[model samples]
Target: MSWGIEIYEKGMPIKITGRSFIFDQIAVTQNGSKTYNNIPKGRSLAAYIVARNRGSYFTVKVENNKISWNSLRGSQSINGIIMVLIK
Candidate 1:
């Protein structure tokens, strides 16, 4: 995961939002595999978890504003693409 203030979706090319985190020293892991390094976990505005499927490329964006991790059902997915936004 990269860090700064901008986050981009894989293959999308465009940043997700103005508050997206785009940094050079962030740690990103996929399917339990480390993908990036030194990810910031203490930023108040930073997203704690950003998960993207390697196969389908579906992305999950989780911010730190909320105090709960909502549940998502696998059946809710469309085209096997499931994107979860947690806050």
Candidate 2:
């Protein structure tokens, strides 16, 4: 049995869109031990942020197929767009 989910079939880019408030965090976990290729490492994942609140910062962490993100700011709701390239 395999719990792995293929985010991309041809190693294409996937775009994810969401909204977040200050101090809000998001976590995405792949349901298997298999890891995707071309996944950014550690804080470098922030580079995948296509659009976010100005003056705000994003914290990203990737371990295996799990990804966590924290939106940092004092007070504000922001729309976040992230593009992930999977191989």
Candidate 3:
């Protein structure tokens, strides 16, 4: 908090940290999109990064109360993903 950006939640300070989760070990049909629910609410920004992959690509985004990862190139099956929440 000495330099750069600082975050707060309900008047409490927040750390710029991330959480990671893994994708199911199965086939995701080509050009398909999957939604992950029960994401934490009330944050300034929510973003994601691909952790690992097998043979597909992804375009990840956070919307409303869920996160969606679309197999933009083909059948997307990733090893894991990191969800970063910024307050």
The candidate that achieves the highest TM-score relative to the unseen native structure: 3
For residues 1-87, what per-residue lDDT tens digits would candidate 2 score against the true structure? 323322332366543333211221332222212234554454223224445546656555565555545555534444554444332
Cα lDDT over the full model 1: 0.33
Better of 1 and 3 by TM-score: 3
Error of 3 at 69 (Å): 0.6
Residue-level error in angstroms, candidate 2, position 85: 1.8
Compute the lDDT of residue 11 as modeled in candidate 1. Answer: 46
> Model 1, which residues run further than 4 Å from truth?
1-7, 10-44, 52-65, 74-87
For candidate 1, the 10 contiguous residues with the lowest summed lDDT are 78-87
Q: Which residue runs of candidate 2 sit more than 4 Å off their true CA positions?
A: 1-47, 74-78
The TM-score ranking, best first, is 3, 2, 1
Q: What would the per-residue lDDT of candidate 3 be over residues 16-38, giving only the tens digit for each residue?
A: 43332232332433333445454
* TM-score for each candidate, following the candidate numbering: 0.21, 0.37, 0.42
User: For residues 11-80, what per-residue lDDT tens digits would candidate 1 score against the true structure?
Assistant: 4534445454343222223222112233456544333334534333323333343222222433333122
User: Which of candidates 1 and 2 reaches a greater TM-score?
Assistant: 2
Q: Return the top candidate by lDDT.
A: 3
The local lDDT score (0 to 100) that residue 51 gets in candidate 1 is 51
- Candidate 3 accuracy as TM-score: 0.42
